[model samples]
Target: MIEVDEVCKSFTVRRRSGRLRRSRTLVGAVDRISFTVAAGEFVGYLGPNGAGKSTTIKMLTGILTPTSGRVRVSGLDPSRQRTALARRIGVVFGQRTTLWWDLPLRDSLTLVRHLYRVERSTHQARLAELTELLELGAFLDTPVRQLSLGQRMRGDLAAALVHDPELLVLDEPTIGLDVISKATVRAFLTRLNTERGTTILLTTHDLGDVERLCRRVMVIDHGRLAYDGSLPRLRAALDADRILIVDLARAAPPIEVDGARVVRTDGPRQWLAIPPSGNAAAVVAAVAARHEVEDISLREPGIEDLITRLYGGGVPADR
Candidate 1:
C-alpha cells in the first residue's frame, strides 16, 4: 500500500559558529530510505529522535515533499495527488489534534465528516459506531479544550477515521496517554486492522506499542533503513546477548563470572550479557560458585536494547 524508493530528505540547517558567525550545513533527515508495506499489514516504523522517522511520515502523508527519490501511497504519488490520496488515509498524530479546540467533540467530528464529503447516513452511522467504540459519549458534548489528554487523543482518533479510510497512519498515537487510554487506543487499532483490514503504518518511540500492534517492524536510523522484517527475526538476527542480572549479598567489584561480559554494575547488582548461544545455566553456576549470590535472574533483550545497539553502532543490516 506504501512504497518508498531511495527516498532522501535534506534540509539546510544553520549552526551558530563563533560570536556573530554562522555555518550552513546540509542535514540529511532521511537518506536513501526505501521500504514497502503490503496491503492490510500492520507495520511499525521505529527510530529514535532525529532519526528521520517523522521526515519519512511527513513525505508519505504529503505534508512534506521529499528532496530526492519517490514515495507512492496506494500507487499514487502523495505529493502530486495529495487531495485524492487524502480520502484513502486516516492519520492520528498523538501530540497534535485535528479537532477544533473550543468546539464540542461532536461538532469537531461533524466538521471532519463534511470535510471528507461523507454521506449523511454514512456519517451518522460511523459517528455512532466511533462514539460507542471510543467511549466518547461522555465527552461527545464536551469542548475539546476541556477534555483530558487521553480524552482528546480518543477524539482525535475518532476524527481521523470518521470517513473510514482504508489506511491508517499513526505517529506516537499513545504518547502522554495513561495506561488505560493506551490500552483503549491499542484495542481500537487492533480491531480496525484485524476486522476492517485497514493497512497501518505506525511510528512510535514506545516499544510497547510496536510489540503489541506490529507483526512486521522497520527500523530507521541515521536516515537509513536499518532493519525490516518480523520482530522475532529482527531480534534473532541481532543476536543480542541475553542478560543475567545478579545481586550479590555484598557490594563488590564487577563479578568475575566466566563466559559472560559485565555490561553494567550497580554496587551489589551486576548485569552480565551472555552470547545468545552461551549457556545460561553454566553462567549462573559459575557465578554462584564464586560469590555470595543473593539473587539472580535472566532477562531477554528487548526492542529498546536492539535500538540502542543500532544507534551505538548500526546493527548489521538485515532485511
Candidate 2:
C-alpha cells in the first residue's frame, strides 16, 4: 500500500552570525529511512516532535517534496502523481480541520461530494452510512465551528471516509477527545480496517492509540528508524517483564511458579514477573492449577514506558 525507500528530507535555516552576518545550516529532519506497508495493514509511525514524522507524512501526501529518496502510495509516486494519489487516500489531521468553519456538516460533505466527483446516489448512500457509523446525525446540520472537539473529530473521520478511499493517513485522530470519543473512534477504525480492509498509517503521540490500533509500529528517533516490527517484538526487544497479579482464596506461602518469579506478595494477592518473551498464558494456567484462583490480571509492558526507554533523555520536540 505504501513504500518509502531511503527517504530523506532536510531544511536550511539561517541564523545571524554576529550583528549583520548570517550563517546557513542544513538540518536533516528525516534521515535515510526505509519501510513498507502491505494493503489492509494498520501500522503506527511514531516519533517525538521534530523527529521528522510530519515531514514524512507530508512527503507521503505530496504536501512537500522529499529532498532525497522515493515515496509511493498504492504504486504511485505521491509527489509526482498527487492528483491520482489523492483519490485513493484520505487524510485526517487532528490539530487542523479541512472542513469549512462556517458550513454545516452536511454542507461540508456536499462540497466534498462535488470535489471528489462522486456519483450523487453513491455519495448519498456513503454519507448516510458514514453519518450513522460515526454518529454524526445530530450534528449533520450543525456548523463545523459550532461542534465540540469530539463532534468535529467524528465529522472529520466521516469526511475522510465519505469517498471510500482505500487508504487512510491519520495524524492523532483521537487527540483532545474524551474517553468515550476515543473509544468510538478506535472501534470505528478497527471495524474499518477489519471489514473494509482500508490500509491505515497512524501517527500519534498517544501511546494508547498505538496500543489499541496498531500491531506493527515503526519508531523514529533523531530522524532515524529505531525500530520496526510487531508490538510484542518491540516489548521483547526492551527486555522488560510482564506482570501477572493473582488473587488466591487464602493467604499462603509465596507461590513458587516456574518461568515466573514473585515480585510482590500482598496478603492473598501476589505479583509475578514473567520474562517479556515468556508465555504469559502458560504461566497463568500453571499457577491456577496449583492454587484456587479468585482473580487474575496481566499488565503487559506499557507502550509509553517502552518508548521512553527506547528514546532515553530525548526531549519531545514541538515540530
Candidate 3:
C-alpha cells in the first residue's frame, strides 16, 4: 500500500560561525531509502534519535517534500495529490494533536466528520464503534486540554481514524505512556491491523512495541537504511552468540569449556558466551560437572542493544 523508491530528503540548516558569520548547509535527513509495505501489514520503522525516521514518515504523509526520488501512498503521489492522498491516510503524531484544542472530544470528532464529508449515518456508526473500542465515553465532553496524556492519545487516534483511512502512519504513538496505557494502545493497534486490515507504519523508540506488534522492521541509521526484513532475521543476524549465566553455590576453581568463551566472572556467578555453532548442552554439562550449580539462565541480546550497536557504528556481535 506504500511504495518509496530511492527517496531522498534534505533540509537546509543554518550554522553560525565566529563573529556572527552564518552558513547554510544541506543536511540529508533521508538518503536514497526505498521500501514497500503491503496492505494489512504492520511494519516498524526503528532508529535512534536523528536517524531520519521522522523525515521519512513526513515525506510519506506529504508533510515535507523530498529532494529527489518518488513516494506513493495507496497509489497516489503524496506531493502531487496531497489533499486526495490525505483522505486515504490517517496520521497520528505523538507530540502534536490534530484535534481542536478548545473543542470537546465529541465536537472535534464531529468537525472531522464534516471535514471529511462522511455521511451522517456512517459517521455516527464509526464514532460509536471507536468510542466503545477506545473507551472514550467517559471524557467525550471534556476539552482537549483537560484530558490526561493517555486519554488525549486515544482521542487523537480516534480522530485520525474517523474517516476510515486505509493506511495509518503512527509516529511514536506510545511514547511516554504508562505501562497500562501502552498496552491498551498496542492492543487497539493490533486489532486495527488484524481485524480491519489497516496498513500501519509505526516509528517508535520503544523496542517492546516493535517486538510485540511488528513482524517486519526496517532499521535506519545516518540517513540510510541499515536493515530491512523480518524481525527474526535481524535478530539472528546480529546475535550469533548465546549467553549463559551460571550462579554457583560457592566460588569454584576457574573452569574451561570447549568452544565457549568466559565473558565475565564475579564471585560465584560466571558468564559464558557460546558461539552459534557450539553445542550449548555440552557446555552446560561441563559446567555442571565442575561447579556447584545454584541456577542457570540463557539470554540473547535484545533489540535495543542491537539498535544501539548499529547507531554507534559498531558491528553487531555474533550470537
Candidate 4:
C-alpha cells in the first residue's frame, strides 16, 4: 500500500565559523531509500537517533516533501494528494495526543468523527467497538489531561481509528507504558491486522514491540536502508548469537558445552552464547545433564546489537 523510489531528503543549515563568519552545509537525512509495503502487512521500521526514520515517516505522511524522488501511499502521491490521503491513513504519535486536553475522551472522539464527517450511526458503532477492544469504557468521560499515560494512549488509538482508515502508521505506540499496557496495545494491533486487515507501518525503538508484533522488519542507518527481511534472516545475515541463561542449584564453575560457550557467570547463574546455527534445546540438555539446573531462559540478539553492527561499517553484504 506504500511505495518509495530513489527517495532523498536534504536540508541546508547555517553554521557559525570563525568570528562573524558562517557556513551553509548540506545534510542528507534520507538517501535514495526504496521500499514497498503491501496491503494488510505489518512492517517494522527501526533506527537509532538521527537515523532518518522520522524524516522518512514525515515524507510518507505528507508532512514534509522529499527533495528528490517519488513517494506513494495507497496509490496516491502523498505530497500533492495529502488531503485525500488523510482519509485513507491513520497516524498515532506516542509523545503527543490527538485528543483535546480539556475535553472528555468521548467528546474528543466525537470531534474527530465530526471532523471526518462520519455518519452518526457509523461513528457510534465504531466508538463502541473501539471502547470494548481498547477498554476505554472506564475513562470515556474523563478529561484527556486527567488520564494516565496508558489511558491517554488508548484513547489516542481510538481517535486514530474512529474513521476506519485503511492503513495505520504508529510511532512508538507503547512508549513509557507499563508491561500490561504494552501487552494490551500489542494485542489490539495484532487483531487490527489479522481480523480488520488494516495495514500497519510501525516505527519503534522498543525491540520487544517489533519482536511481538512484526514479522517483517526493516533497518535504516546513516539515512539509508541497511536491511529488509524477516527477523530470522536478519539474525542469520549478521550471524547473531543468542544468550542462554541457566540457573544451577548451587554455585559452580562455567559448564562446558560443545555448541555453546560461557560468556558470563554470577554465583549459580551462568550465561552461555549460542551461535545462530546452534540448537538451543541440545545445548540446554547438555548443560542439564552435567550441571544441576534449576531454571533456564534464552534471549535473542537485541536490535541494538544488529544496529550497532550495521552502523559500525555499511550494510551487510548478504543482506
Candidate 5:
C-alpha cells in the first residue's frame, strides 16, 4: 500500500546568462501529484519525457525529498524512516543497475541478502525461488558486466526481490529489452503480483507494458496528475471516435458517412472517424450496400494515441 498526498518536488538548477552571469531557476519536477495504490494492485504510471513520473517515484522511494505534501509507504514516512521503509520496498530502475559490475549475479544477490539481514535459510529459499522464476540459473556465475542487457535486468529484478519486499517500484523495467526478454520479465511480474500479492507501481514509456500488466493506470503530464483510473476508463474517455477502414472493389470518389468524418483516403481504401454515438454496424452496412466493398475493418484508438492526445492538450471527454 502507498499513499501520496499532494506531493511536490522541485529542483533548483543553475542557469547561465550572457557574460557568464548565472542564476538559479526552480523547476517543478513533480507538482502536487497525488495517488494511492492498494495492496496487490499493479498500477502503471505513464507520461512523456520530463513528465514528473520519476520524480514522484523517487519521492515515494525515499531517494528524494518532496518540497511539500506527504508520502507514506506501508505506513512509514519514507523521508524520516528511510531505513525501515527501505526494507519493505524493492526498486528497479531500467536505466541503472544495483549490482556491482565485477560481481557475479549470485554474489550480488548474496550481498543484498546480508545487507537486508535475511536469515540464511530464508535467503537460500527465496533465491532458489527467484532463480527458477527468473531463469537466472543459466548465468548465475556470470559477472554483471559480462551478462547481456536482458540477463542483467533479470539479475537486478531478482536482487530487488531477494528480501521479499511488499511493494515494488519499477521505472521503465522493460526498456531496451528484446521481445522475448520483455515477455519473460512480464510473465515473472504477473506471477509475483498474482501469487505473492505484492503492490506494484510501474513507470514505463511502453504502453504495451501497461496494457499487458496493469489493470489500472495513472498518467502524469507537466508535473501534474493528468489521469488516474482503470485503463479501460482512460481509454474510453480519450478515444471516443472509432476508425472505419473500408476498401471498395475499385477507387471511389470521396464520400462521407453520416456522423462520420473522412480522415484518410488512399485509392479504394478510405478511413473514416466515426463518432461513438453513431452505429458502426449501420455505417458498415450502408457502405457495403452502397459500394462494392472488398474488405472492412473497425479500429479503436490505441493507448499510445490516447496518451499523445492527452499530452497535446486534448480535453478529456467520455466515450
Candidate 6:
C-alpha cells in the first residue's frame, strides 16, 4: 500500500548569527529512510519530537516533495500523482478538522460527497453507515463549532471514511480525547481494518494505542529507520528488562540480587530491573532471603519503555 525508498527531505532555514547577519543552514527532516507497508496491515510509526514523523507523513500524503529518493502510495508516485492518489487515501489530523466550522455536520458531509464525486445514492448509504458506526447521529445537525472535542473528532472520522478510501493515515488521532472517546475510536478502527481491510499507518505518542492496535512497528530517529519489526522482536532486540516492584515489611536499603538490580527505592518499596530472560523466581528468592518481604509483583516491559531505550541509542544494528 505504501513504499518509501531512501527518502530524504531537507529545508533551508535562516538563523541570526550577529546583529546584522543571518546564516542559512540546511536541516534534514527525513534522511534516507526506507520502509514498506503491505495491504491489510496495520503499522505504527513512532518517533519523538522533531524526529521526522510528520515530515514522512506529509511526503506520503503529497503535502511535501522529498528532497531526494522516491515515495509511492497505492502504486502511484505521491508527489506527481497527488490528485489521483487523494481518492484512495484518507487522512485525519487530530489538531485540525476537515469539516467547515460554521456548517452543520450533515452539510459538511454533503460537501465531501460532492468533492469526491460520489454518487448521490452511494454517498447517502455510506453516510448512514458511518453515522451509525461512529455514532454521529446525535450531532448530525449540530454546527461543527459547537461540538465538543470528542464530538468533533468523531465527526472528522466520519468525513474521512465517507469516500471509502483504501488507506487511512492517522496522526495523533486520539490526542486530547477522553478515555471513552479514545476507546470508541480504537474499536472502530480495529473493525475497519479487520472487516473492511483498510490499511492503516498510525503515528502517535500514545503507546496505549500502539499496544492495542499495532502488531508491527517502525521506529525512526534523526530521520533514519532505526528499528522495524514486531513488538516482541523489538523488546528482544533491545534486551529490554522486566520490572519487579518489591515492597518489604519495613524500610530497608536496596535489595541485593544477582539477576536483578535495584533501579529505584522509596521507603520499603524498591524497583528492580530484571533481564528479560532472567528467572523471576530466583530474583524473588534472592531478595526474600535478605529482606523482610511483604509484597512482590512483576511487570513486562511496555512499548514506552522499549521505545525510550531504542531512542537512547540501544537499538540493535539488525533490528
lDDT of each: 0.91, 0.89, 0.89, 0.92, 0.89, 0.91
RMSD of 5: 2.6
Name the TM-score of candidate 5.
0.90
- Cα lDDT of model 6 by residue, 290-309, tens digit: 88889999999987888788
> So what's the TM-score on candidate 6?
0.93
**Which has the greatest lDDT?**
4
Give the Cα RMSD of candidate 6.
Answer: 2.0
lDDT of 5 by residue, 1-319 (tens): 8999999899999988767899999998998877788899999999898999988888888889999999999999998888999899999999999999999999999999999999999999999999898999999999999999999999999999988999999999999999999999999999999999998999998877998999888888889888888877876677568889989899988656676778889999999888767898989888887889999999877677788878786554321
lDDT of 4 by residue, 125-237 (tens): 99999999999999999999999999999999999999999999998899999999999999999999999999999999998999899989999887999988888777777
- Per-model TM-score versus the true fold: 0.90, 0.82, 0.88, 0.92, 0.90, 0.93
On TM-score, the stronger of 1 and 3 is 1
Model 1 scores a C-alpha lDDT of 0.91
Better of 2 and 6 by TM-score: 6
- Of candidate 6, the 10-residue stretch with the lowest lDDT total is 310-319
User: Compared with the true structure, what per-residue lDDT tens digits does model 1 show for residues 138-183?
Assistant: 9999999999999999999999998899889999999999999999
Clashing pairs in 1: none
Q: What is the lDDT of residue 159 in candidate 6?
A: 88
How many steric clashes between backbone atoms does each model show? 0, 0, 5, 0, 0, 0
Any runs in candidate 4 off by more than 4 Å, and if so which? 247-254, 266-269, 292-295, 313-319
